[model samples]
Target chain A: MSTSADTVSMGGGNNSPSIRAKVQAFGGFLTNMVLPNIGAFIAWGLLTALFIPSGWMPNEEFAKIVGPAINFLLPLLLAITGGRMVGGQRGAVMGAIGAIGLIVGADIPMFLGAMVIGPLGGLIIKKFDGLLENRIPAGFEMIVNNFSLGILGFLLMLVSFEFIGPVIEAANNGITVAIEALVATGLLPLLSLINEPAKVLFLNNVIDQGIYYPLGMQAAAEQGKSIYFTVASNPGPGLGLLLAFTFFGGKTSKRTAPGAMIIHFLGGIHELYFPYVLMKPLTIVGMIGGGMTGIAVFELFDAGLVAGPSPGSIFAYLGLTPKGSFIGIIAGVLAAAGVTFLITSLILKMDKNTEETEEENLNESIEKSKAMKQEGKEVSAASEQHTTQIEKISFACDAGAGSSAMGATAFRKKLHKKGIEGIEVKHYRIEDVPEDANIVVVHKDLLDRAKIAHSDKEIITIENFLDDPNLHGLLERLENVSK
Target chain B: MLGEHLKGNVRFLESVNSWEEAIRESAAPLLENGSITSKYVDDMIQNVNTNGPYIVVVPEFAMPHAKNENSVEKTGISFLQLQEPVMFPDDKEVKVLFALAAEDSTGHLDLISDLSGVLMEDEARDELKQAKSEKEIIDLINSVE
Candidate 1:
């Protein structure tokens, strides 16, 4: 069951995660919630691709799956899952209830609204649950919880119908008008500036599911195909970046980008490229350049697709293309890749760290470690000397995934090698950390947050989580307490 | 692994007033074994106080752990089956508590992986819930893989 996310306050301190982090987290959360049901989306895409009269093997009877899949099941599932992530079973119920408003209020499929409304409803129910926690008397808990959700859900449903329903309809209309105007004026390529960045930030599903899918469905129902489906869902820009990174980027990118390229361009999981781009902010300009070129090429060729490719797979894009439009689609993809590669190669030249040979790099790290250990012994012997046992050591980060989790694992391995016993080392999201944590290890970027969260506790900042030299100091302090 | 703790540390508690009490009861065996320090126990209970009960990880089950690296004297896992379920603030009720203490993050991973395997199988979890003695619980764990 999903609970409300601990609200992270922004604009508080320089060390707190940026506004970009919050948006990225929200996008990450949405991506995670929707990812499990990718198969269902594929099923709908397949059905639409095969049976839509102009399809490969048109079958009207089998095509019946399209309506239910698009109109009800997809959005219904998204709401339940998104809401469940926010609240729990109660939240899921209310989120599903609230989502029905967007579904019935408009002629278009309301998957985007479901993504928002369900989570919002669940969050509201969770807030109510929090306020009433411990206040509900024993034996009367079940009834009160049930009645509260029922009343609150009903009120939310009304609010959704009366207020939210119309608002979404109007917003959808506004966007549609805007897109039509852009397309008419040959200014549609400008959308790549917004869509490409959002896509790399992992808002691909929201753009595809919320905006592209519904609009494409409407257009495809009237015409044979919709260019709107191909606009944001193109795999070209990401492929371009990966190709450039594979051949021209630093050693790390050169090694990893090929595998990522395979997963992204071929497998159609656009998310594989996000981390790569995130690691190098300057690389986004390459993606933006590629995205604009892709759109421009599509416009040049007048290319469109029968359906939105679920994973934005290159193969699926080709399959969905009209008989005569195959060259146009291929041209757009190649042009996007060529443009991205040219820009990326230039940007990567400024990346100086990856130039060192593996042996030299290893030697440098070893020398650095020796210097750090020498420094660590003195630091441990000084004012931070342990007088009492530390029961808890928490490795905290923004999302608590990459750095903190790996740091804890590496630190654990170090402790095991040292024969250290009975120390609980774990990774946690900064906000979810328990107050009982004796020592909090956080990234230097998150030091301010750690200080604010645990003012009384020891806050250790690690500049590089992967090879944190301060871990030795922490271990030395732990050993001193044990002695 | 969990086998050592399961053989001697597993217990069936008759009753508990609150979730905190249940956690304390669950960790008592670990504390007795010197697997965890007394301060670790307090910290574990305090984790719930601060973080709410995200510990009820699976249905009818709770895995209460603390970030108390210093409180850990050994790596161990203890089981406590409550006769009556204790409800957390989130309205989720839990009957089984797996209190884990690890001196380091990498230690006791095999035990956790095995326990998760047992928990995933409905029949195994049911067998665990019904087993009255530690030997039976040990047998159930052995039988899973």
Candidate 2:
């Protein structure tokens, strides 16, 4: 569960006149700020683009200088800039320090490192910024305050990079190796079997962070030479569907899927099929199967492209792809679609039976519970009495503040629509919630605290309050309680 | 050290017609003041023309700068803002500019980072944008807590 206040409070006091002024001044500073290193990047890019092509500089020497600088320095600058954008001077210094880890880490691209580390660095600095601000004394405030604070922030940023950089590097290495091994074992058939059903029916594409893109990009980046290959290899279950439809799909899927695929392809967005996957989980399985097969075929042919594969649609593939891998790409698409379609058709027939059995089991549990209540058991009384006391309720989610605040907003909207008032509604992070709260709602993943607090109050599990109708009903019941 | 680098040379501009004009216009003062050389201004203009609007480095802010060695008459800072918001293709919005003139890369690194921090805050950024006069802008800059 998330609440509006939690979300709203994360940015903290943007409405304050002074804070607004700070933001404006900071924006001006960033706009007018100059870094000499950027010229290094421009000069490097120009030399590489012009001289490298004309054979003025040998490829080996060019790669040594240009590759490391563009990959490392440019990202370092981005991290510093991003941090400054987020946290001001402290953030900029912190972001730059954090970005330095990417150069040392050497595995992850600088742009990606900057994108991740800069924000993380800003967040860490933001956590301590208030504490530092509070400790500044009155007399020497102007000199001692920002100066010491800047030094402290810079040191903290360096320490954070030292600690976090290794963990990130190890994790990247682990994932890369795992993906490589999976591809090398020629396990596409088994993967296709699992993936097709997951893609078509379970909304596998919705969890790109968990699947597809990470694996694809990791494999491509680790195995391939060019940046273009890394970009082109973005594995998307949605792209799996498009490849299936365009190259080998039946008439019905071909027409509808192509239009949606085109939008995602050009835009570099791949989450467009979430609604479709939710409605038909079987289709998702097909997509997963297709993705697995695609990777396998791609490996077999040793095809490569430039750039990371974010916009994983075909148009981006063709438009940005380096010359001479068309056959490999075609083969990869066919292999993916063939494997996906086969696996999906077989699994779709079996799912209907499983779904019926699951429904029956749910009904059986409800009947059993009702029968137990009719027997006047004291255990039933505990549940009944507990439900009665939950008039006012609140919950928490990630960032404890922001998501919880958003949840509170949704809960209130639902409460209003049902004409339920007088039941106080609030949101908090799990860390900040009061022990006296009568009813607490929390994300299913973060239910440990709620369970512990359950000794005093009833706890409701919510999968995300944003659009959960079932959660709205549960909230309505809790709010309608007279006590 | 950051304050020393920033003193006297920083200016608050009223407005400019476009991002290109803003850079050229903003750099003019720093060039005349002997804080930077004409070559620095030329390089910044060229960088912007070649690279898409990477200068709008912060939200509602743009920094028009080039390689420090190109300009470096003396290490300095200049501030400018548009009467109307200018578009940086990469940025969401633009109103303020910080044109930096560093003699070398290492000389102003710390000051550049420190100055970036001050301007990154929404409160500071808005204050600078709303300043009616150079005195107010300088006061706001001096008032950073």
Candidate 3:
């Protein structure tokens, strides 16, 4: 089967094959990272709901243990994750601090607050990361400077949360109230139109602004009002795409479409079907038509979801939805299917020439690869000589403290696993190097600095250190020499 | 029972050099009055190190108390304010400490809730912030319905 990777190489012009490879890799990376955490969170919830109320655990003791753990430990974990997401120790520390602020500063429960705070923390960390990179002193060691900058970043976040958190909280609450009123007015039809296209194109923004911002939507639902709304609300367009594929997609698409549908149904990750929709833009019109149909069905059945959907899976619908609304669920799904299938069929028929063009591009990419390979000669170094040289390894990152430390640790571990020896691995900020380092590792954006500092050194550029598995193996080889 | 026992032991301070000093000074009367033990104060300090700035759970309000067994000669509350705010490195905001000494954890819920309610009110907080004398501060606290 020709995957998107194969297609990318074939369609090459200005678009590099690596870009598509990265996108595919990140999609899998994100899924692996988040899915386990989701399971952990749900298990915690179930344990609390079942065991605490049943008197298996003492409330005071549980509060003492859970309260402090949730307040401190959870934020730290979030910071680490956030740091990994952005690629540095500083981002992780900032993320952790920001998560702490959200956890402590807001009245929302700790677990729920994490979902909102983790990303905000990532953004804050990213901002400071840029600021710190710009202000690095000319002579100081990059790692040491990053460590000091991290302390300053932590202090800044602490102050901001203390004095500024209240104002931000107030503003956030006001927005939440406004959104609740909009949702309660049953303006689903209008919202569907605006939100359907948004769901397809700008999915992340919709998740951030439309869904995650209002942390207490479930609590607000108890009051019979909430402002948060999205097309992912009921039988969302993502599900519509799945249903369309099941009923009307080509033989290959139909076979795979059911798994995507099941994932959307049970897992609540509607984005699982994004590839299918992106492959066919005509599916957008189908999504809108399905969305409108779903809205009408929701209104007809009087089925409502307390929390706005980002995941938009059947399990979340069952969890947050009011009881005994099976008919509403079914009607919404059917409406979406009806609209999507009709629209997708028309679009597919109109675009029959696209396949021929794709094949021609594929042929061109193979020719280009052959030519490039012929021009690039292979190395002729003796294996014994290459093994003996002490490879001076250096890392250049956004912040030198948190994620860099983690990366260093991972690198050392990898080196041990490889059973290689005689490597000196050290982490540096973008500009600092001891002049004799044999290998310089840096983020893609910091390549210019790496080029300037270690013009003689072999440079390995990474997009995000935390996300790349190959970097781990490379670091491991470097560490083997040190051991 | 903890609040009733500690009522006469609570002390009020006008200013202090640091949050640590404020905590030690406020807990002194409780210690002297045999309302709480010195070991309890030590534990509270240790707690702060392990857990960052939980005392400043709310704005301008800090509730510093240890476990029931730490000292607890009796239950009591202490109020301390600085002429200028003292910075706690753990928290970015300047805190005027409102330390509570409890003999046990459970009995003082009503008293804790009452104090929390009074602190939660904006007008009472403003009045508390403005008070120049210990007597004035006491009067302001007593005035909460």
Off by over 4 Å in 1: A1-16, A135-142, A195-229, A242-260, A269-285, A305-312, A315-326, A342-483, B1-145
Worst 10 residues of 3 chain A by lDDT: A375-384
> lDDT tens digits, residues A122-158, model 2?
6566555534543556577678756755775566556
Which whole-number lDDT from 0 to 100 does residue A185 have in model 3?
Answer: 81
| Per-residue C-alpha lDDT of model 2 across residues B1-145, encoded as one tens digit per residue | 4455445545555566667777777676688878877788887777666544544544666666665554577777677766677776544467877776657534554555455445645687788777767667666766663
TM-score of each: 0.50, 0.40, 0.41
Give each prediction's DockQ, rounded to 2 decimals: 0.02, 0.01, 0.01
Q: For candidate 2, what is the TM-score?
A: 0.40
| lDDT value, residue A72 of candidate 3 | 59
What's the alpha carbon RMSD for model 1? Answer: 20.8
Q: Per-residue alpha-carbon lDDT of model 1 for A1-483, expressed as tens digits? A: 001001111111123334444444444556645766666766676677677676768899987877777777877788888788767688789898888877776676776678788889888887787567546777999899989988988887788878887887778778889888999999988887777766654456656765776677656645556778877888898898988878876676678789989998989878677655655556778887888898889888887776667778898888677554688899988899889888877877777565655335434433433333333333333312331136568888654433455556666666666766546677787886788788899866578877888888889976544444676788776776655
Q: Which one wins on DockQ?
A: 1
Report the CA-based lDDT of candidate 2 relative to the real structure: 0.53
DockQ of 3: 0.01
Better of 2 and 3 by lDDT: 2
